[model samples]
Target: MAADELKLENQVCFALYAASRAVTSLYRPALDALGLTYPQYLVMLVLWERGPVLVKELGQALDLDSGTLSPLLKRLEAAGLVRRQRCAEDERAVRVYPTDEGGALRDRAMSVPRKLSGATGMGLAELEALRENLVRLTEEITAQQD
Candidate 1:
């Protein structure tokens, strides 16, 4: 390949990175309306699906550290969306549970996926293919990390 042809646009990593940012950007305005960031929205999803879960498990699920997640969890608590409680089995462990407000937020948030899908102009099958590819890529990256 020519030196000039080896530019950043030609790199798959760059493309993926840019696409990820772009997709996240599309969510920003919508998320902002709900007073949440992308990471916070992810945390809500996890709580909605799993209910009261440990803080460490949340970090692992989101690939975040305590340094990052602690403050976020605190903010969620302050917002009345979630509550943090010490685990009975382990005083050192903190568990997160969504409040009624948080659970109700899911009803409002249910429209988001459909709105995003419409914005992307991708049909269900195409979206599924994209999701599958991304999942494979994520697994490969996680394997490399190990």
Candidate 2:
């Protein structure tokens, strides 16, 4: 029946949502060891790759809004990991930069991906393909918002 098609177990969105929560939960223990939440870890990963970045740029990279990012940045600052400084060229914009301690945490965080991959029991090629598909899915959905 048509009504049967509406079951929660049949929804793609529900599957993605459940998987996302499970993955984040799995990362909790490893991230907690670094004194970072999953969201904080994401911010740190961007900072580690790009060095100092404007808050707005960071938001774009993480698909997060200022309201959500503000508290995370504040917590990072409070923990002595990152510093937020007013950009000299654009005084209205704030740039976030990692401190020496934050950079040092990179070494400890390096094992996280490996540990997570092992837990998933998926080969690198399969994971890479899955990531590609998910990225395409995200881009297509995001384009629809335009």
Candidate 3:
């Protein structure tokens, strides 16, 4: 059964990929009501957690490079959900901040996590532990790549 190692069902990457897509799909309806896509919602989460951040920093936090992030930021700006401004002391650096409307949306978005948690039928502690393990696995893989 050596060939079994190559089977799709035995691939950890495929499992994670499938799980990610499934989780993202579950977020769709909730995100749609917020007028935000999954990536946009992620950006908002970072902003809501950390008031304002530089474009470079935001990119790093999201594990996205400028090429992929720029379009998302543009759409977010177009929606008036976020504002991008050049830093006064560093013209080359752009900082992103949530606009008033975006800040207001935070209150309504609070229910999203609770809803998703209930959908999982898992307790907070279990989810948190799983999240920690996933983060560790991601970090290990990333470090290996580096």
- Top candidate on TM-score is 2
- lDDT for each candidate structure: 0.92, 0.94, 0.92
Models 1 onward score TM values of 0.89, 0.93, 0.91
Residue 66: error of model 1 in Å?
Answer: 1.0
Better of 2 and 3 by lDDT: 2
Off by over 4 Å in 3: 1-10
For residues 1-146, write the lDDT of model 1, one tens digit per residue: 67667775478778898888999999988888888899999999999999999999998999899999999999999999999999999999999999999999999888877678778877889989989998998999899987
Candidate no. 1 TM-score: 0.89
Q: What is the Cα-based lDDT of residue 112 in candidate 1? A: 79
Candidate 1 wrong stretches, greater than 4 Å: 1-10
The stretch of ten residues in a row with the least summed lDDT in candidate 3 is 1-10
lDDT of 1 at 43: 100
- The true-versus-predicted C-alpha distance at residue 21 of model 3, in Å, is 0.3
> How does model 3 score by TM-score?
0.91
Error of 2 at 140 (Å): 0.7
Pairs of residues at least 3 apart in sequence or in different chains that clash in candidate 1? none
